[model samples]
Target: MFVFWLVQLISKAIYLYTVLLVIYALLSWFPGGYQSSFGRFLAKICEPYLGLFDHLNLSFGPVNFNIAFAIIVLQLASQALVLILNRIAFMF
Candidate 1:
């Protein structure tokens, strides 16, 4: 029971973080948006995770493809974690 709740909490946190990442990516499109304090904070929180995909250098002529890929990956990971937690809870 406790484990289930804990997993739920963690899952929610991850989902929220993913949303923040999305916001960060969107803000990047505006000039000087990333220079704001809030933007910097978002970057600090999101960069490490997004940085993973950055290594792939997934880009076209101008678009940074990795940002989309990273967001998708984060969503998939959050879903998978929740699914696994539910499965474990069911087994117990």
Candidate 2:
């Protein structure tokens, strides 16, 4: 049981870390400007995540905020919530 909980926590941590990384990449696009090929590559790789917003016909300053910050924030919150719920479940 403890091992299962540990695995769950680790997975949630990984998920939240990924969410933050995506947020950092998307946020990097606007301020000052993106000068690296890596940034462009990330943008391309992450394009599908942003595509959902495009389907909704929303835009944020030439970029899709719906998929950028919003998605990151939501995913982060979800991961956190799941972790909390798991803890509560274990406690009980």
List the RMSD of every prediction in angstroms.
1.4, 5.0
Model 1, 62-85: lDDT tens digits are 888787898888878878888888
Candidate 1 at 47: error in angstroms?
0.5
Write down the RMSD of candidate 1 (Cα, Å).
1.4
What are the per-residue Cα lDDT tens digits for candidate 2 across 42-83?
Answer: 666565656555666557686645655556665776667767
lDDT agreement of model 1 with the native? 0.85
Off by over 4 Å in 2: 1-35, 60-64, 76-92
Q: What TM-score would each prediction reach against the true structure? A: 0.87, 0.42
> What TM-score number comes out for model 2?
0.42
